[model samples]
Target chain A: MSGLKGWREIPIGGLILDAGNAEQYKTGSWRTYRPVWDEGKCIHCLFCWIYCPDSAIIVEEGKMKGIDLEHCKGCGICAEECPPKEKAIEMVLEGEGKGV
Target chain B: MGKIVALTGNDAAGTAMVQIKPDVVAAFPITPQTELMHKFADAVADGEVDTEFVLVESEHSAMSAAVGAAAAGARVMTATSANGFALMWEIVYIAASNRLPIVMTLVNRALSAPINIHCDHSDSMGGRDAGWIQIHSENSQEVYDNLIQGVKIAENKDVLLPVMVTSDGFILSHTLERMEILDEEDVHRFVGEYKPAHTLLDVDHPVTFGPLDLPDYYFEHKRQQVLAMEEARRVILEVGKEFEKLSGRGYGFLEEYQMEGAERAIVALGSTAGTVKQVVDALRERGERVGLIKLRVFRPFPKEELLEALREVKVVAIFDRSHSFGSFGGPLFTEVRSVLYGSDISVEVLNYIYGLGGRNISLEEIEGVFSDLQGVIERGGVKERINYLGVRE
Candidate 1:
């Protein structure tokens, strides 16, 4: 409901002309759990960057920046995709500071 | 402003394409239809017409490319037969829903599995509900004329729907006939320039072509298509009238042949209508009260005209070339019968499935149906509603 519209507010053919406008909405509010990235334990393999459906993982110069919470729905996909035994990422309850 | 020439229906349609000189033509080769695009490609190679010819890998890609060109607001066209049209089935709906006025020359061939490569209405009939303006041609002349007018009818501001001009495969597509070709200038004047209302190539406006619509606006968009179809009826007739001005050949949603003051009639489409007309003439010479209804437009099914024309006819039968298996009868039969529902008119409608896989329908076979109608008229009831014409069983 954020800048996007239902059919009633669209043209006959429903064309989305305003490019990159989906990023305006704060979809992170929908997530009850958010992924906490541990900088110390992080290997920055960028598994989350490759698998984010919404392009929610922030990447800079081919390296993982962090989770882009503005568009992330907090699916904990990054935690699941983390490397074995490293446990570089953990999902924590919303507004509970750091999971570590 | 037209030249008389001998050409097959496929070439005639290709001749029309050459005159219209569309911006892009994306197509794949299939029987009967391949020659139509071959002629178009020849025109492009010989510098007769300036066109970007795309030899796509498959019919699905053919339609996909055609849809893309159309969205970019280019005047585009293509040709395909049975299985090729089936391959294009996915984008067929998308082209219409996107409201692109892309015209296609659909040479009708029987759908495969029993593996047919010959004439039948099943190809176009299969895509009947695909939201495109469908025009049926009776002969080479009609094929050429319909394609030209088809371009206009589809591009009409009110219509803005894709159009499929069909000619029966091999029968009309390969059979050579004498026809008049309109002058390139006259065709250019009539077709004019295509101006899409909303083009994907419009950078300033930046309108998207295909967008996902949830339930909220989907119904409204579909309703708009219904309205566009409603407008198409008027546009088709108007374009036909305009075409008549140049070529002296006119068109209508459905054609009534010797229907006046007649108590009996045979209805059909494509080249079979030509054979039926000859039989009707012979029957009339014997003082028979038989007439013929050659349906030209199947979609936006001419319900009113059909009802009004058949109101007084005591007995009528439709020669359907394609069978709608598991249904009551063939595609044309189901539709023509649907319009005559609840009518007080005592019209005994019969459906005859004929020419499934290029089965030759002789004049004697056509006369037999008329004779059966005569018997039904005299006896007051039909023996079987749906019957096969020439199959050995």
Candidate 2:
């Protein structure tokens, strides 16, 4: 509420006046759980990359690198879609060791 | 300055619509209002206008498409009556809240439970608080004039709220009468082209409309609408004066007829005002002190003008064509009474709900209302505040 706009200061008609302002919103604050990647157990099949709902799974040159915590809502779709045998991606509680 | 021709209210509205040449029109057919769109469709087929006519399956979709077009920076218009108006209730609010200037012709009709399809104020009266400027008409002439003027009022930069120009269903919609129409070039110049400040089609500066307005700012947006409505009061007058220059007939929040030294008056709206005016003239000839207050605009409830108009009258009867159902009196009655409550002038006000489901109120019945006002004056007070006019009971 401190940074929220007043009725007159804000744009008229409840319109979002700027383009590509989604990054400024930082919806990552909504996450309560974080995904942890096990690089050693990784086959890099890229299933987790394909399954990330927020497009938070960072990939480069057709290979999975790691998860981008800036967005990642911790939905765990990547963890569930990862191969059961590999189990390279795991869901962990937020604020746990290296889980932030 | 314009050509005089005989046409029904529907045709007159269609003629005005063709002259305005809105960029888009989305509508569904309904009783009374059906012929209006039919006439516009005929115009579209004949290539008289270059509007994109979207034939939607339902009134809901019609309003939805109108909102989309208006948000996309197109001049949009539509028409509906009664049940059709009821169907479009959701998007109707959306169009106004989004501050889109979509003009709609609301043919006044009875809302159904008994499934009646004739003239009544139930439909538009129910939508009085929907954030749209409501301009009521007394005849085909007003129907034609108000529609053209509605465009300028709705699109006024200071007031970008949607406006509904209403005419009585069947009474005005079906009845043919002589009225003047401005030249196509004159109308085109009067309304000018619609240039919205922000639009969804602006590619360089992309913007989102109708976003989720949470508690943080919902109240503020609503306040903005209130301010716009306040501005509309002045704009309606300015536009009316300018329109009078072109058409020689002026308009305002309400029209006062024969109020000079009047002891009694009747307040009403729509075509019923036409009947009341006849009664006022006949009564005036007989040397009876009576008058008629024809309320043309009901949205911005003209408190100051009404107070001045009713100053000299001792007692007044407000004729409402629809009922408020379980309320103490009809909608107009309540509002008019409230306006006079704290004023320095003390005028006894009575409520009469009449003509529901298109029940006709004859000239004699109107005279009887004035006579009833005489009785209230003689009795020194109103025995019954709420009276049903022409009802069987």
Candidate 3:
């Protein structure tokens, strides 16, 4: 809040003049649980990427790279939708691991 | 000057909408307001106008679609009354807070519980504080004129807020009256082109709307709305002046009838003002110093103008067609009194809650109000702060 614009300086009509500024704000802090992706048990079927509500699943060359935890809301949809056979992703309590 | 034509209030509103030809209109049917939409929709279907008429399932969806279209930077319009307006209540605030210049016709009707489709101010008064400029119409002509002016008022860059132009339900909506309507080309010239400063469709200058405005900046945005409303007072008068030039019909925040040298007066809104005008003329003929201040614009509250209008008056009877339950007085009464509060004005004021649920406030009742004001002056003060008119004992 240190240099936040006052009412006079801000854009009229409460519009965010900068488009796609959502990335500048992180939603990961809102999470009570975070999704953990296992590299070894991965099927790379890309189900987690497809199910992420926040588009937090990072995909490179059409393959799952890792979770973009900065944006992940930890809704457990990625974990819930992961095939039971592979069980590549699991929900863990937030702050359980180092930088989890 | 425009040519004279006979039209009902709904038809008059529809005529204005058809002429303005907003880029988009999302409509759902409701009493009083339905015919206005029908007029616009028929024009769209007949290829008379190129307005995109979206048939929404409900008033909520109607307003949501209107908001979306307006954010995309299209000139948008919609209409509703009573419960339909109530249904659109949530999105109505969203439309205003987002600062979309959407012009809507609110044919004033009673909000439901008993559910009667007739004329009343309950619907529009319910939205008096929703950040939209509220303009009340006395008759069909004003309904047509206000709708045309509303577009310009809402789209004014200095005041880019939604405006709800209201006509009393059924009283004006279903009643035919002779009024002048401008040619489509003339209306086009007056309203001119809508050049939105920022739009979702303007990819070259991208922007976002309806973002999560938390405590950090929510207060600031609301402050912006407050300034915009303040600016609207100037813009509404400016537009009214420009419109007067075109149509020869002058309008202001409030229209004073026989106010000069009057000691007692009645202040009111909507179709009741027309009835009150008749009483004023009758009383004036009988050498009674009674006048009226028919409030044309209510949302901006017209505080200074009202003070100026009521300056010479000693006793005032304010007629509110809607009740503010459990409050000291009706909405108009409280507002008029509040404006005079802490001021040099030492006028005696009274509130008469009248015509609720579309009960007729006849000419005699208006005269009775003036008589009551006369009695207040005779007695030197008010006995009751709030009184009901035209209701059973």
Candidate 4:
């Protein structure tokens, strides 16, 4: 009953990506790179959050946060503008069939 | 045999339709194109042309009926002018998008807030982006020939787009001229039968025509329409070649008159092209390096061909009968600038808005346009507002 009853209907939240958090998820070949945030060298300057054209980056508790890749076009403007001691934002190659 | 009988442009179009023998003709009479519908009605009454003539109550209904007839897999033809054409605006776009091979004759007239029934390009210009292949004719002969060729071009399997054969209203529609009429048998052989890829009345096939499309598919359909128009450029030339073989007069997408080695040139379309050419010949007799480029096809505008024709000229004066309000530029002038935006050849382009509201464009006024262009060429440029020739101060 536990496995079969719960399995028949997947949670709606899990079935579809949350629209608000979509910017953190990356999909498609058109997106060449996914933004990676480096926690160690990060400063809470929030320059990346302010400059991301897609508003992909979100800031909470006065700290730099990760991007919602689902809605990000992978334009890399945030990666270029990161103001940490070492670049906190870096672009990572997206895996095949991983992005929408 | 060549006939010397004088006939109006509407008569010429109706005569060509008779000779071509289309399956259906739906029209509402509007000046100055009522004669065309009248002649067709007479022909139908006499049992000369075996075709269905639908006399609709309104121009809107006329175009809608034509669209329906075309959808039923019949070769359809219609004619309207000015306000009458404006009335048909909604269905005109549908006729092209639905890919119905309907051929329409638009006797170009000035649109009215003040109500003027005169020769102007406003009617056609207003509907420029309505997705029809627009062809302008310079004279009655071109009008007659274009109507004949329009059917062949529109029905070509590779290019199934609606076509508009436009001539100057009143000026061309009412003017009488001697034109060569092709033998009826030859025209019949040329146009052939109307065979549609998808038809509304085809019960066996049962295809959905003009269904509601969502945004994703709507864009794809428009893209396909664009591809069809680009394909029409080649189809038009091929059709023109076949027509030349049959009729002995060659027509290009753009006709050049003494353009080679000319220092200055005037660019215009419709019946005014003939008038401009006459003026060019006279000026050339006085050793002026002036020429005329008559644009035959306006929509799917012959850009490369136009630039090629005008590349060597130092100054180009565009004579536009229609104005693009609030843009401070004539429609033709805007298109010309867009065509030569990044090109190395920088010919000085000037816009002269003339002959609007059926005002007579005399030879003197045409010469004045050339004189303005001459001034620009001599002094490198001239400062003048959009010169409206014959506009009462």
Q: Would you estimate the TM-scores of all the predictions?
A: 0.89, 0.94, 0.96, 0.79
Top candidate (DockQ): 2
Query: Candidate 3, clashing residue pairs?
Result: none
lDDT of 4 by residue, A1-100 (tens): 2233232232111112123444333443358777877777887778888887777677778876677766677888888988645797787777632332
| Candidate 1, residue A98: lDDT | 74
**For model 3, what share of native contacts is present?**
0.86
| Candidate 3 segments exceeding 4 Å error | A61-63, A98-100
Task: Compare candidates 1 and 2 on TM-score and give the better one.
Answer: 2
Candidate 1, residues B335-391, lDDT tens digits: the string is 888878876666889999999888999999999999999999889999999999999
Q: Which residue pairs come into collision in candidate 2?
A: none
DockQ of all predictions against the true structure, Cα-based: 0.36, 0.76, 0.74, 0.01
Rank candidates by TM-score, best first: 3, 2, 1, 4
lDDT (10s digit) by residue, model 2, range B283-322: 9999999999999999878999999999999999999999
TM-score of candidate 3 to 2 decimals: 0.96
The fraction of correct interface contacts reproduced by each prediction comes to 0.49, 0.86, 0.86, 0.00
Cα shift from native, residue B3, model 3 (Å): 0.8
For DockQ, candidate 1 versus 4, the one ahead is 1
What is the per-residue lDDT of model 3 for residues B50-136, given as tens digits with 9 covering 90 to 100? 988999999999999999999998999999999999999999999999999999999999988797888788899899889999999
- In angstroms, how far off is B272's CA in candidate 2? 0.2
Better of 1 and 3 by lDDT: 3
- TM-score, chain B, predicted structure 2: 0.99
Q: Which is the better candidate, 2 or 3, if ranked by DockQ?
A: 2
* CA lDDT of each prediction against the hidden true structure: 0.88, 0.92, 0.91, 0.83
Ten consecutive residues with minimal summed lDDT in candidate 2 chain B? B205-214
Runs in model 4 lying further than 4 Å from the true structure? A1-100, B1-4
